[model samples]
Target: MAGKSQAGGERIEHPFDPLFNEYSRVLILGSFPSVRSREQNFYYGHPRNRFWKVMATILNCPQPQTVEAKRALILEHHLALWDSVAECEISGSSDSSIRGVRPNDLSIILKKCDIRRIYCNGRKSYDIYRRYIEERTGREAVLLPSTSPANARCGTEELINRWSVITKDLQSQK
Candidate 1:
């Protein structure tokens, strides 16, 4: 799927590597990186996005303010971060605009880590993962409400409540 690009004739590809380690027990997947996230080379780079806020609240930790802090948060919690799509054509930050989907090889992380549960951050991620990765991996991801600013339907309390499942599972493992 091709579309007009914001940068003349150039289409954007996913710009960052997946974040995971041998310690990762849970994998959290987004649809793809937004333009801002690509620029910042990190997941949830947009300041207005509530991903970090929701994560901080769920984990009872300070909100991550830097790339290092964000990495630390995920690593410390045995969480892995990645996107469902490895590469795609997108007009902007909109997930709806994504096309030419080439999904990430989740097995890279799956093989390296003992990931017990997989979680998708929003509808698109969940749908893609369900359609592609789940069948091959035999691991169905729990779909969580998006932390994107666009998803105004779920407020902080609701997000916190819904996202508690991740933390709950983490606790049970301990």
Candidate 2:
């Protein structure tokens, strides 16, 4: 949980493993885990965060309310989930407060999965992915409006519309 210092504050190391499997075809990355997520030891643990709802709407599945259900959803859709930052100095959950970022080595999932497409959940994540992972992997990620509660500018409907792209190719195949 303790990480290196940056400026005056302490950075926090990412505490969980990336979620994926050999069947994974799409990769979704966030900037970093929020404090609530860190406490819950799962992605998008904040109640107000709409990530699970948005994904459920796009995939035509019931929204997940528990970690087990969330994992099931990701596995069922052949999607991988992780964060762009392996560690960073952040004040609360604000992406703007992030500094001294150490990006995650996404090759853990990339090497194990087919991972046809990558999608960043927010601007910070998108920037981090482009700066670190994209060049190394030669895989460009699509930017999706964040489902974070902080991103109130994008409504639930808009998020679903934008996020539907993740399932578009799969839907066509079915």
Candidate 3:
């Protein structure tokens, strides 16, 4: 249950959209976007969040400094985005409290694409995916450290280190 925000003087719909396509080789899953993300209408729009920065750095892509550019960067890299839950009853955006979670129909991707890898953006995504859909797909997933600033237990350098593995695959393709 979410209320329309009066901030920014605009109405927002679908605060967080999992970005992905059939051709997408990588999938970035965020638990859910914050109110600010909904208001801005983009993924990881929060300046402090490092998902884009970490991925861009890993891929050696020009760091996307703006929201539109970030979208372009992901598409340019052939990555797809989709939340683990297709629909859920959530109080605010906290992943811990998401209830009645229903996973998005992934058959579209399975039928149309050659998804080489399914990388959950963080542990929450991985946990949900593993419980809800992984067995059905019968594919192993790689759990990347959460890029959310909320996960301050780990340092940025450490996060970058874990993320380098994903980058290495892209480099090897070259």
Candidate 4:
């Protein structure tokens, strides 16, 4: 899907609502949707992103294929998912090329859920959240490595090991 042109570049508006409910206990954030994610209109739509695999391994659930299944995997585990950015100018799906940021208001989810923790899927998301949302919420966000295929140095196993921290908070709430 093509984004709107802005200042001789493409500016994409986040196309989906945050996945969460009153029962959600953990909030997981990404910087913004990738081109593939935007095309599919879901988070981590890229086949090789490894987010679903990591989550499935840590949460001990099957890797979800369909959007509904993914939603179920998140909500059933008391997790919420969203991006830190509401809209931005990006080049193709490159996080390094991202600019013109407008942050999403996380209060919408925070207000409705008893979120015990906030996690950022990558450095970009963590940085964006800290810069834009952390002060308002007065919450610290844990930064996890990027699950994008571009982050090849951190394999699935390594990602799972790092991301297992999510389960700590999830289990504590249970």
- Across residues 146-171, which tens digit of lDDT does each residue of candidate 4 receive? 99999988998999999999998888
Ranking by lDDT: 4, 2, 1, 3
Superposed by TM-score, candidate 1 places the C-alpha of residue 14 at a distance from the truth, in angstroms, of 1.5
Question: Model 4 — which ten-residue stretch has the worst lDDT?
Answer: 1-10
lDDT tens per residue, model 3, 27-146: 666665655676687787677778777888777877888777887887777777766766665555556666666776666676665667777878877898899888888887888888
Q: Least accurate stretch of 10 residues (summed lDDT) in model 2?
A: 1-10
Candidate 1, residue 41: Cα displacement in angstroms equals 0.4
- 127, model 1: CA deviation in Å? 0.8
The better-scoring model by lDDT among 2 and 4 is 4
Estimate the lDDT of model 2.
0.90
Which of the two candidates, 2 or 3, achieves a greater TM-score against the reference?
2
Q: Estimate each model's TM-score.
A: 0.93, 0.95, 0.82, 0.95
Of the two candidates 1 and 3, the one with more favorable TM-score, higher being better, is 1
**TM-score of model 2 (CA atoms):** 0.95
Clashes of each: 0, 0, 6, 0
User: Can you tell me which runs of candidate 2 are displaced by over 4 Å?
Assistant: 3-8, 172-174
Off by over 4 Å in 3: 1-18
Model 2 residue pairs with clashes: none
> What Cα-based lDDT does every candidate model obtain?
0.89, 0.90, 0.70, 0.91
Over the full model, what C-alpha lDDT does candidate 1 score relative to the true structure? 0.89
